[model samples]
Target: MAHASTAAAEDSCPLLLGKNKLPRHREADTSEGRVVERIADFQGPGGIIDLVYSAVFTRGIEKVKQECLLEAGELPLVPRNFDCWLCSTELLSLLMRGSALGNVGAHTAEGSPNTTWDGHNTIGLLSKSEKDKGVPIADALKNPLTPVWILHGGDHFTVAWCSAATPAEPGSKFLLHHWNGLPPGGPRLADLEITAIKGAISHGTSPSKFYKPEPGEIEEVVQADPDDKTDFPGQYRKWRYEVMLAFDRPDLQGEQRPVDALPEPKFQQEDPRYQRPGAWRCCLCYDRRFKTMDFSLVPADSPDWCQKCSRSRKECGWSLWIPFAELPPKRQAWCMSQYAKKIEPLLWTKWPEAEILEVSGRELPDC
Candidate 1:
């Protein structure tokens, strides 16, 4: 009798259907009278501006508020005076099923209509949890059809997609695209190498090899800017985390090796500043001009010096040059405090076992 009652309850459930009896929820109504009507008016490829506007006006605002309360234990109240920055979860939802007209069916690991890559959320790729699952940064670059979104400094969002660089060799590079809402033009595009993207994820710094501009490039880029758009060559250096989208394709294989091993940073030991057991040295020339600048004259409070380099203060310019070991405790405390809010959370969450104490005390590990 108990078994018969259980079967009856399952049969009556609205989600169960067909001979297979698979569980499936009903799709949100996208009829003529709803938000879909407004979204339908937009034609062609819409960028982040389009995505955000459609999402907020439709239902994303309420959805994000509920999710924030459930996950973070606080409501994200939007101020009437300024625009609110949406989190990765809310942004992913807007791309996935936020609107009938703009819907790309983009799938994510943490948001509603949850989809997993290899049984884990794709967003995990940006965090320490990615050690176990999700698509590898290498494989994502190889496949041209895949789209990737990157979250930086917990505040900004950028999109990337693979495209053929030339007819001779298809899928040669990935285009780093950004949407400028202020100018009212199309998305701006830039070329990004696969190796550089991998390196940035592994090491915390943007590899200089990828972002270093060629001669005359900076001048040409400066003249073309509208002031609202970011400085082209410099923006690549600020990335913090990335997420791979699983929309329209699910069969892509994820990397099995540890996330840190994707590509060991080639330049970690090139400069002494990044090294442990830091020593006092001229900031301008590293060790090249150590004899020219006297460290003994520098005050304990203001370690920074101007016109210290006797050779040419005009040529060398004014820059604070102090070794990691010689930095005053107060300055050291200030440096640590800045990282506390944004970078510390990433360190603790992604690498729980890491010794995150000051560089003076903690031993440098192989990253």
Candidate 2:
């Protein structure tokens, strides 16, 4: 009798098909119009922006949420970059601008429950948990504008969503993972070489024997960038190698709060003591790197010294554009060391023909 009843109960239970199956007694509704059954759940660090291999979305109780599988290999087809960034923005905007209440943050400074940066909840972007203090996991992924979190690794990049109140699987429309660039991925090392060759030609320099020349090739000394190419068609002659290094964390997405937990700094007034005149500053931070000028000394129309924030550029050897944005904290410091910084650009230039050396970084989800 007990065996018959057990068999009947098993038959009555919903068919087990997808990867995610909640524990018994949770009573998840799978019927249409009810809570739709999500394929999987978001499992990873809360505050860091994770590079998802794939993702999905559904509605939750009060607000929408997302369900992401950080490690799942096969995922619903979607553009890699856009999907992730959209998900991040949606969730963050809700937390920052919306009136939704919950325990996104651990506690407010006054000991009351607070969900965001003190006083201002929407001033910044996502902060990685390892770098911030007591920020909820959901906030980091919602708004990537302030943090500009990127998911880079594998074939596709992605962004994820999280909810602090419900530690369970996400179920909302906030999940997305759109791909950008080439579906096959970005330029290869050989592609960069061809770019160098083209640049050399544009500079009116004959091809040199720096890289292995063809069977019937002539050698000539010339100054040229390694990424340019003379003949666009000849670019295919060079062997291309894809250099995919680990970036960000597989289980991390974006940070929910400011790293310092302090209000973002505000400049009260221009200090006359250290006054700088006629300098073009970055629109965002107004960092003094773009172009510093002195109208008092130099003509306004004269060439101005504009320094860009190294963080914005891609890292390359001759470019010497190794910015902290591309590297982790420890590696960033180490890269800036006198020895490493001095040698890195040289290594890139002298060894243009050499294969790219793979650097190990935090492995992120494969979106």
Candidate 3:
């Protein structure tokens, strides 16, 4: 990942790489408005840089522009000689019709980048307009040429144009993403009278400040039996028992006490040889006397095994695992059923009894 503030410090054309880079031709190449040219001089007052950025864009809705201008009235200003930046590509998604969060990346020479679908993408680089929502309106409208519009009732603002090549096409619309400042306004943009624009904005707040109930909110304490083999003892015993009871298994019918819970797993840790990152053998599949390692170069820590053996290294001096793909259907079914049956008695102590019954494969008679 590139460090923040690097582009403007050392490069000539901060928008695009290289010296004398021409204004981007494809409107799609820019964020909100395509930044065509930028000239900065470090000779300004006390060596502070004086920068002027030239942006170009296709025309857009007058109503939207007006709304944005009105909202812009509330934003604050950037200190002199400082460049405050915003990009449309980052802000456009937030300004769409619904509160639906759209996925858009920054203005890379090659459009927004493809992203991973694993749901971890949270970093965002926004256009100056989007950031303007946090400050006063006057501060948000630093650009002189681009048009501005306001959604009348309040601080909501939208830029006049999206950019030249990627210009807001005829009938193209923007989201009220944010306001840098109250664009010479009164109520916030969310209070604007624009038709069908209500309830679309959400007041921002910190999630860490929100309240959450303590864990096991409804459980009660229960004493453990003296003969119980489970390691759990005393005061916290009931919570363990409740969890054991809540274990969902189709073949199990009654409540499972802590003892009936699955035993703490015993990992193979004693032998340094098999303890390598990818080495592991299932206790139920092999018959060797000295644990033969599966030499497939599989990561020793992988959860899957190549083969199954019927004995464990500790108990029978050998360990094995049937390759997962080759396991007989009947054996796999039997293992699943056995696992389910083992946990059956522990179902439903904390959850509603109805849920427990559904999981236990026991249909209740109609009332």
Which of the numbered candidates is closest to the native, going by highest TM-score? 1
Top model number, lDDT: 1
> What lDDT score is found at residue 163 in candidate 1?
42
Q: Arrange candidates by TM-score, descending.
A: 1, 2, 3
| RMSD of candidate 2 to true structure, Å | 21.9
RMSD of each: 18.6, 21.9, 25.1
Model 2 CA deviation exceeding 4 Å by range = 1-85, 89-367
Residue-level lDDT of model 3, residues 32-52, one tens digit each, is: 222232212323442221221
Question: For model 3, what is the error of residue 267's alpha carbon versus the real structure, in angstroms, after optimal superposition?
Answer: 30
Deviation (Å) of 344 in candidate 1: 20
What ordering of candidates by lDDT runs from best to worst? 1, 2, 3
List the global CA lDDT of all models.
Answer: 0.30, 0.26, 0.24
Q: Name the Cα RMSD for model 3.
A: 25.1
Question: Which regions of candidate 1 deviate over 4 angstroms?
Answer: 1-36, 40-64, 77-145, 164-187, 196-367
lDDT tens string, model 2, 93-157?
Answer: 33343312323333433554334433333233222321223233233232322322233222233
